[model samples]
Target: MIGSRVKYRHLHTFVEVARLKSVVKAADSLNISQPAVTKTIRELEELLGVALFERDGRGIRITRPGDVFLRHAAASLTALRQGVDSVSQELLDNVPPVRIGALPTVSTRIMPRAMTLFLEERTASRIKIVTGENAVLLEQLRVGELDLVVGRLAAPEKMAGFSFEHLYSEQVLFTVRAGHPLLGGGSVFAGLAAYPVLMPTRGSIIRPVVEQFLIANGVAALPTQVETVSDAFGRAFVRQSDAIWIISSGVVAGDIAAGMLASLPIDTSETKGPVGLTLRTDAPPSLPLSILIQTIRQAAGEVLPV
Candidate 1:
């Protein structure tokens, strides 16, 4: 029978090597000898009974098993760091920050108002918001890296082990710079292929929605296009060039109102979905986190027709 053998050193070394993609570089980054790093990885692989990394020509690539373990391993490290900080005198003396995961579409519209209100009420509290694709945010939430996530609800399979609170319904919209050539179109969808198209990134929450809308409109493919999830990039790119940006309504609501952009006359009700907050079912939020959630709800009420 194997005795207790796994340790923090093993996981730490393995993650660094996987991240840096080189044993030597990981050793340098971890301030250890290459031999020690290699030995640690070997030990971890033995304990797990699976090869985590395999040589890919000169470099190394993580095996399917290693890729699977990487997510949990990194999450464990993040949890450990937060756990240590939670009890530290320095952290205990001060309020812990509310770590949040935000979607790009929500960040531009709802986050600023919610965060402003949250900070105003909890003057001593700090906030750290990490924004990314829906899958990434949901994974982070499930693994305890984030206190809560605010955005559109993801697909059910990816939404395992979390509770979503529906706040409002938001639609997807097509927009371009005011008075663009696509404006006087017979059918904007027909004209879309001629202009440069900006689409939601492949992994983002709205990517499938945008793609489905386009496909249904006979825009199955385009010659010139960019796929991104950056609201700032989309805003700038669409305004500067004859680019048609398909994005959530809230992201460009302010711009459309100010005449910096105009929404194409298209009925896209099918792309509408519920925007809301998501929290881990097993993990209860801290007091500051709860307060922040409340403030966010209040802000949403004011800004949206909730």
Candidate 2:
């Protein structure tokens, strides 16, 4: 009722000029002209029947009434600004996170770098990463629980409803802590058969590959001492003891590079296979997922061939 003629233009111009202490700056910030800012403030004072500012040498001074009005006016604008931001943030939060399943290898090696790039590519978007055996991840993909899967291709029968896009080729490798009993002076096969061994969890894509490699090398019976897809457990267990860890190269590439682990000299070319992206054949990737897929590819490129 008191400000029936007052407008957003009047309040905004006055508040900005007062805050900046310069009409020239307020006009520049608002992308208007100096005279326009002065004119608008004058209009606001006329409508309110009060002098909002007094000329103070080259600058300006706020009147007591202007000070009171400014406190309320600035607060109102701040509330409006926050309301706009909250609405935008709510919309972003409402968007379902892009759910993904990653094989242990990809989760450890590829995802860390890919996540950094993905965040850069789409700062407002979000994602969820699930890591486990190949069979488990594929099952999650078949359901609606996952939008994508990254790592080696699944078994032929398991490929019925999923499509795979080849990313790179990697192979199983034998590794142990930097200083282990098996590091010198023994036949590799004998050491593998004799020492406690860690292997890929059963039903993982790499599990079969590793089994075949062992069989070819005269390690006919798989080690039952430990079978897991957990990088943390494998690294910890192997480091504190003399257990040999047979895992995909990507999973321990960093460890080997850092000298925390060592790869044995063995031939696993027969176990080499394609690693790739898997998705439901029936479901097209959402735009955000597609961008993330690209980011993963960029990250994957950094993985050195084993």
Candidate 3:
């Protein structure tokens, strides 16, 4: 009977070559000799009893069998890594906690619930949560300080090395205090003009949608009295004054439930924003981060409106 003889390093080398589709390039990337890369590939193919590549005069291509083999090999590697990471992560005496950046709105509402669930599931795992605007969050993501960012991304045209996954759409609500004059009902825009507006600072994804809708309908601009990124401030301002605040329904769901704020009878039918998760492209995420994101998607699916 043949004994178990698979080597972990060989599997890793095979994955790198398969991913790059060129032995020389893979070797250079791994800082090894090309022949060493070729030798490992051959040894791996022999162990599996399958031809993994087809070489022609032009170049080499992964064979149909090779493509199938790669799928299994990648899965195996991913499983092995996840297992190893779970163990080694605990022993990482000096490695900082997995740092995650989240938008303030998300951090305030969904993330607290998600984090509580994550901690319950992973007692040994450590995480650092940072809150910021998208511009700051994306920069931290690119510099490797952050593993994942939860928010609506800014400027897809300029974001070449990042990928975004839509978690859910947040409904935009224009809200005010319960007894505010506009409380019962009125023309949405004209009513807005009577009250000072609490607006998200410019360039926020929320701002453009609100501004454009008001302008397109020829709704006169309300007095822009407060501009801030703090949802707490916005909600507090609404409770104390006649200022109208445009915000995500999910963020203020609890407040609305408590009767702290009242949703205006305005047509928000045209306003929807994607609350998304952003990750670095062409890279595999850390296992803890990956599981956390998966949990977020599941949680978002359950809570976010369709």
Candidate 4:
């Protein structure tokens, strides 16, 4: 029986081979020789007293034992990497700051209120907020630069390393300056076609859905007065022109309340969508991060107002 003298490098090498399914490929990835990779796999199998890989005429295949071992290997690697990151953060006096990335809409609205509540409770911790489009934010979350994100979940399916917690739904609303011809007495959709519309940039998640809805309803080729992604610009453009601006209700609540903009009377039943929180699927969130997520969830519920 091999005693408690096993090293992590041997297990890591085995995992690399199992993942790549070829000694040459794994060796190249690890910057080691194919023979060295083969030896490590053999050594790992011997230590475990099980065949990790079955090599046939076609190629190598992972056995049942190999699958089980690979699961543990991957988990162990993740834990080791996390430990290293924790230690590095400590050495740098980083204090395990919770980095949050959010969509600009949320960044300006619910995020600030939630963060205020979070900071009140966690006075000792550090918090960082980054704002961008959903795609950019998700990419940051995947790369570990963000502990969590509060934004629309992107995709055909959720990415492997992330989990989403649905916070609330944002209803799309079209607004125009007060007393504008298309205001239609504070209706959401009324008079939408009387004036050219200003929309978010074409690549925004809501753009396609909004366009499709308009086209399906026989409102195709609605004149687009302009397109801009900047929230400030959107609000300013609406304030200065009769151009309509579509925005998430949660994002423009303050402007609506202040009487700077009025929602047109159009039925937005077709434009509602999920707005939620995303975090790494496999990692246990840090204590501070957990608290922040809850606070954001609560704030989102309140700010969206059904």
Candidate 5:
């Protein structure tokens, strides 16, 4: 039997506090006083008859029960927001835009073509794409901030509440400016360490693979290294210097085709990873989301190799 005392405010407050692990931070985020936030949490705990958090001098930690409840609370909030959006769209006779989260590789290479083809076929459709690291995007999808995330499959632990559909695989590449001094070098092992190396940041799905590749090739570290996942910065940096960039091939496919950049002779097929769509398991696809997925499938078929 459920109690009538629980309210949305309680769930919302609980989620904020759980996310930040601090009542003060949660209160600031909610734009409410600390006492109000604390009161709401207490009320929620009383209604449920379970303690959600364990407080300490440093901060609070979610109890085991709280961890489980947090999932349900977050899901409930997501469902409520989805319902509100659906009602608003129906009342306005407008389709709510599909919100997509993407990683840099997909956003730069695949999405432009996909978006163009989708809009051309469905003239009234609207899409909003946001890009970030794999973990951030997955969390946004879990909380219903995004309809789906299109990117490389994350590790199993990072994919708890989502389902992934594989679209294609992409290989990482070692690339440099056109006519870079190391271009025709017989063995890149010696020359690679001599130039600045640009590679993905630690959290990116491709980072470990790149590190492993370097280790296998007996290169302990680059003389100079810069870590990033920005396609724009990578392109400009490589074009003007002898720096070698370790990145997914799709990120610079256009530049390679245009003769502005060149990939080294190294074969990175071993570092290939799956690029795919991730959706919340609890949320079934809405009509707009389905349409976008279908369009993306078509676009991938045309642009990506099987």
Candidate 6:
């Protein structure tokens, strides 16, 4: 059992070191000496009655207990920060801000419209938007750092502690520049392997489906591949090169509608996935959060392609 003697500083230091995998880097990030960082970790380990990390050569590996503790420690720190922010807002602005996490797909297509409509109605409201992969966003939502997350459904294991509300369904598509050579090719997949490809990052929920689709199509490996989830990079790269981009249909909906990009004619129904809202089961929504959720539903109805 962990003792109450552990300090927040200890947990903070431990999390930093675990994240960086180097005590010196953690020390520099925290603006403290390396020895002080080590002493804090030691104290926390003693209090918990478990070794948190193991030093091997020049790097450190978090022990099993450390991995478990890191989750709780990070959650605690996030909760504390939220509490401070809430109190500060209540004291000064008399209104608490709503924090939201959105995956790139929704951020690019739906959020801009939703945010505009929401702000138009509630002009004084404050909303903070964070963009990241599903796992990172869900973790933040779980820990109360975010009021909710809007994105594709995560794998079953990652959805363990949260509740999801289905918003809509989305499919992955293979897209290219408007006038790419593949446009009139008799064998699209055959010629695809000759050009560079852009794939979703590993953390994306649709990445595995994208890989499976490629395998099913008999393209064993792309000649060249770039993995990313940045909409700006994707837009620029595809417009400037012959690289094929496999991504959520919603992300490039505007580009497709505007004829800036073209979706391949290949059927991709097998890659369909649910996009939704993820929330902590234990927490009730604040007024601002509740309002935003309604606005999102409305905006999705308006913006998401049929």
- Each candidate: how many clashes? 0, 0, 0, 9, 0, 0
CA lDDT scores, all candidates in order: 0.88, 0.86, 0.79, 0.79, 0.88, 0.89
Candidate 1, residue 135: how far the Cα is off, in Å: 1.5
Worst 10 residues of 5 by lDDT: 117-126
* Winning candidate number (TM-score): 2
- For model 4, the stretches where C-alpha displacement exceeds 4 angstroms are 1-93, 184-194
* Tens digits of per-residue lDDT for model 5, 155-267: 99888888999999999999999998878778887788789999888977888888998899898888789988788898999999999999999888989999999999887
Choose 1 or 4, whichever is better by lDDT: 1
Error of model 1, residue 79, in angstroms? 36
All candidates: TM-score? 0.68, 0.83, 0.66, 0.64, 0.68, 0.68
Once fitted onto the true fold, the runs of candidate 2 whose alpha carbons sit more than 4 angstroms away are 1-7, 20-22, 42-68, 179-182, 222-224
Which of candidates 1 and 2 is the stronger one according to lDDT? Answer: 1
**Residue 53 CA error for candidate 4 (Å)?**
78
Q: Looking at candidate 1, what is the lDDT of residue 306?
A: 66
Q: Give the Å shift of residue 53 in candidate 6.
A: 81
How good is model 1 by TM-score? 0.68
**Where in model 1 is the C-alpha error above 4 Å?**
1-89, 92-95
**Model 1 Cα displacement at 234 (Å)?**
1.2
lDDT of 3 by residue, 102-221 (tens): 887788677877876687776466789998667778888998889888987557674779998888777678888888888766666776777788777775667787788778878756
Give the per-residue lDDT digits (tens) of candidate 1, residues 112-228: 988888878745667899888878888888887888999999899888788999999999888899989878869887888888888887888888888888888898888887888
Highest lDDT scorer: 6
Residue runs of model 3 more than 4 Å from their true location after superposition: 1-93
Collision pairs in model 2: none
- Candidate 6 lDDT by residue in tens digits, 1-306: 364687889988998999999999999999999999999999998898899999888788999999999999999999989999898777758666789999888998888988988887764678999998888888888888898999988889888878999889999999999999989867888988889999998977788999899899898988799999888899999999999999898888889999999998889999998999999889999877888898899998887643
